[model samples]
Target: MPKALKIAPPDDVLTMLEAGVAGDRVAFDGGSVQLIDAVERGHKVALHAIERNAPVRKFGFPIGRATRSIAAGEHVHVHNLQTALAGQHSYAFDTGANVVTPLPSTATFMGYRRADGRVGTRNEIWVLPTVGCVARTAERIARQAEARVAHLVDGVHAFAHPHGCSQLGHDLDGTRAILASLACHPNAAGAVIVGLGCEENQVAALLERIPQARRGSIRFLVAQASADEMAEGVALVEELARAAMAVRSPAGLDALVLGVKCGGSDGLSGLTANPLVGRMADHVTGAGGSAILTEIPEIFGAEHLLMARAASRATFDAIVTLVNGFKQHFIDHGEPVSENPSPGNIAGGITTLEEKSLGAVQKGGTSAVVDVIDYGVQVRARGLTVLEAPGNDAVSSTALAAAGATVILFTTGRGTPLGFPVPTVKIASNHDLAVRKPGWIDFDAGMVLDAGMDAADAALLQRIIAIASGEETAAERNGEREIAIWKRGVTL
Candidate 1:
């Protein structure tokens, strides 16, 4: 073992060695000379054996239970330890809560305060179009408008998505709902709606879904009025930017709608960053705010766990219905949902959808699922919720931004350059990667994977608090705000 790496037994739980924990069988740094069974040298000591059916505890939670008897010094691994049961009945939030202790109230983040009692992390001007036909014109206008008024909002940008002009049924409704949510997002201090005058998504319908406060700060333009001219688009966008720059103020954590996501993961991701970010999610949600977890495909093989954590039976069922419905949609398209994993995921040691999912779900933390919404629906509940979106990090992050995520927590084992509309914090899987890619990785949670860091969970939670409260993350300093919207079925 390296001199800097050490391991200490957790004080909260006891580890049983051999047929029983006969003595103070401590797993510490640099001193061990007992062998009763077969074991590998490099593998983690988590494989040490004990009595049959013994429970494996971490973070004071029963992560798994041993399925077979084992001798001392033997590896306690997946082959012998069965995973903990995942179901609604397994966790009892009210009566048998895990953490009944109240958390400190001193925690807070400085954010942009909105008029209707919401908070924003960044001030931005949005140039949105009701139809794809106007997307080019909107982009041109945004570029000019941003240059004209660069000092006002954080940035002026256009979401050039390949949707809003085709299809039928729920797909159209999904697009309309998402676009409306974009217009009302807290990060958007002001907005300009550009339309082709005739498209599947009309400006009137989009405006109706925007909140009252947002409606007061928006401007409208039709390409027909500009004779479909590019110069007209730039002029209208400039006017909207000037108007948006006039309003700027401090916001609070309550105004934040956190977008949670994970990409290019490995086994250590669950053990490290995901759960750490989850702690942050819990804090944000507990502070009378909202957090959004998306990537429908990533949640595959783990929807049942989230359903069980739902605040109500209705919410649970709603999420369950979405999982099944999306699966059916994929089936209709002659593709398996399991095929969604990226090449990087496989190279980094992830296997099967179920195996990957076991860790992916940890990012939601222990918060109750307050709402289950379709793609593009603005988050309304004041706690953890599920957002409908594809597994692609860019697309899901974009939807979260559209639905109002002021910050995104993105985890990766295989480093990604992807950023988001709001600020993003990147957590690395291992210490080696964190040190090697200091420019991209903000925090190192791989200490949990190291030998000595016993309170991995607690330490990570503290780090998350620091990041959420204005601490610069690697992604933010690198200026990463990658956005992509999943338009699975049709443009409309």
Candidate 2:
């Protein structure tokens, strides 16, 4: 195997595939370099001398600037590199640069077709709590209901979150929106919305946000109005399950909506997992399918690249507002816009926010920004849609589910076992992590390093189809389903 990899021709740094001590020579595509300082695996090594304050290129873009003069083969990391990101800047819409050729849409997967014309990868029944006070009640109801109806449908699940009460204005609306969205998710054959009756987010009010056609498949229960909440909830779920027992049928690729995300990212993220997911994104959107990319904060430095692909001037303006609004959120809270790349990221070899952002955006592929939606809005476009969400794993994943992602393509370097409302296919950036956490990873993107992206892409697409057709992901098998609401306002 090559000792290091250079992602782009203009990159002045090479990412080490293995640890190297001083004086060790690392070979790459065009040339070789002897290490001037000891560098760990996945860390960056300068390929040539860099002057102080000069930008260091990676992924063919400036990741950051050199903090001081650096010698050839010197280790490049936080010690010598710093982010150059600041508050947002103006942007201009580029005309006709984002057009994508729609591929032949012959691919099909077996999925459940809903009454509303949406296709579902699963036929499970969901129990949702309107207030935090009734979360456990919902869980208890789902457990009992699943035991009885496991043979009738996929499975029963209750998504519990500590919100729906004590929230004001948009914060309260956010809770309602997410819950309403989940209740209407195509994956759920039917859903039961349990409310505490007196909470700010009442069951009746929440139902108003859901479409009139979708409300027929959903049941609601007010805990205070019930004689026995658990029994009432279970009965409701059983009724939904009976109605949800539908057989899967062939569905076209256009029915597939993917959520592309990355977490616990490492240096190899950009090279392997992310870019691999990017190919899948392109493939999906090329076939007229939809894909959603979130983690607004993670795209700070790379916002321009996405903006350049805006479908129209209106889309470009939305992209600008999305980027700047997130930055302002940080500033208003006295936090820097570049306050990211967590300690885990640093240890995994990522240096600055720019480097991380540049790598993170690859999951979106090169698709045109068809639309930019706010938090809690279900996706309406037929291509890559940028959703407003934070970079936190659960929150963004939940938002993705709420935005109508049937399956989430999650790429990671460091591993996480979390699954959201939908099946999350975890792709590992490096081989070591895939081997180390077999239970957490569904695909090894590290194969791209050796077998190349085409091979990896084919394999991953097959795995995704299988998963969509009812093959359980690692997260699903491990029973790691959960949700987290983005609590952006103060408590009452």
Candidate 3:
């Protein structure tokens, strides 16, 4: 039988588990409703008649207002509904209804310990270009050094980006901060600072921020100064490889910094993958580990849920600003605050930005907001830290990596082929996506719908620990590692 799921008590629509045509019956908790219009799997169906311009409720919140009158059992989607959000609104800090608790510890993983006492899941040498001009040189250096260090390190790679030059103010400063933070990442035991001879992002300025203890392992090269850039680059890379070459030792899981993100989401995302990832967040935080959650825009509608779990009133205030400030970012551009949940998301049963946000925030897993940090800054909090960043996958992933995420858990329903510099484990929301994109998906949470969250949670934990202990994700195996900086300011 094709059944329907009502996520929350106040939900006015049901998400169909399987596709059904007109006259088809969808059974729920008590009675069954015959379909008045066809609905595809992972799409919505109205539970009752909704008048034109009335709020269309899903997940216990109004996703949007009906464009036209909607009959009971009719398919609810983009054609009949539209985003209700217009602009940003003032938010009040409210954290009264919450229980105070402490993060418990119980697990460990094998990792490399840096001189400054930070732990890393991978012991690889990284190459960073001050500008895009030296990107190829950096990659060439990494490719050559990768072969030499194959028997010693996890992997060697160069991060390439388009910016670092032809910018001013915060834009240029952002590039500098992100690159510097990546240079300081615990995962990279050593790094080569590649300069394009005259780029605004100078190696001297970059090197000034790197910890003095790790300076001996870092190398700086100016393309114009060297007679043979390739030779010079490779020589520097070789030095980095030699310094970074080390074996993984048993480290407490508390030392791990995990990044949580979701993209290409569907209705099942909240029902399965995101919640399971949240459970993983609780587990990690409970174990004294850190988990960073970004994509500020996606968490807009559900901002209150996290605010309620904030560790302090100051944290709640910061979160309110984080939410409102992002909303204003859209209004400043003359766009609607809830103008999101891409076409793929709409096809996957998301009607409005709020609907998408409600599902997207499930990845944070009911953890308290310990701190809030801006983009390009290394995270200092140990629990669930909210980062200020756009919802773009590459940009957000790179930001998380810069914030010192050793491993990133990326949940997707429509699926993504991209990966960040760090090991990215893609968790599929549906079993079909997992089956179709085996090379892209590392874990499938669809089984939760059939098996249960606890069982899926255990399986996911096992896979995460395995990856932390030196296992390669699908992204790493396919060599899809990349970086993207959020370019907010003008190019000039």
Q: Using lDDT as the measure, which candidate wins? A: 2
User: What are the per-residue Cα lDDT tens digits for candidate 3 across 54-131?
Assistant: 988876777889999998889988889888776665666665465345457577889888887789989888999999
- Residue pairs with colliding backbones in model 3 are 104-286, 278-365
Best by TM-score: 2
Question: What are the per-residue Cα lDDT tens digits for candidate 2 across 1-492?
Answer: 767874547888999887889999988667889999999889999999999999999988999899999899999999999999887688877884655554544678899998878899999999999989999999999999999999999999999999999999999999999999998899998999999988999888899999999987899999999999888999999998888789999987789999999999999999999989988888889888899999999998999889988888899999999999999999999999999899999999999999999999999988788999999999999999999999999999999999999999999999999999899999999999999999999999999989988899889988999999999999999999999999999899
Superposed model 3: Cα runs more than 4 Å off: 6-8, 99-105
Residue by residue across 153-261, what tens digits does model 1's lDDT show? 6677776665667756677777777778777877777778887876777778778887676687787777786665567666666666666653434434455577888
Instruction: Count clashing residue pairs in model 3.
Output: 2
Model 2: lDDT of residue 8? 48
* Alpha carbon RMSD to native, model 1: 6.4
TM-score (all chains, Cα) for each model: 0.76, 0.98, 0.96
Worst 10-residue lDDT window for candidate 1 reads 11-20
Regions more than 4 Å wrong, model 1: 1-104, 227-231, 245-255, 334-337, 447-482, 490-492
**Per-structure clash totals for the candidates:** 19, 0, 2
Order the numbered candidates by TM-score, best leading. Answer: 2, 3, 1
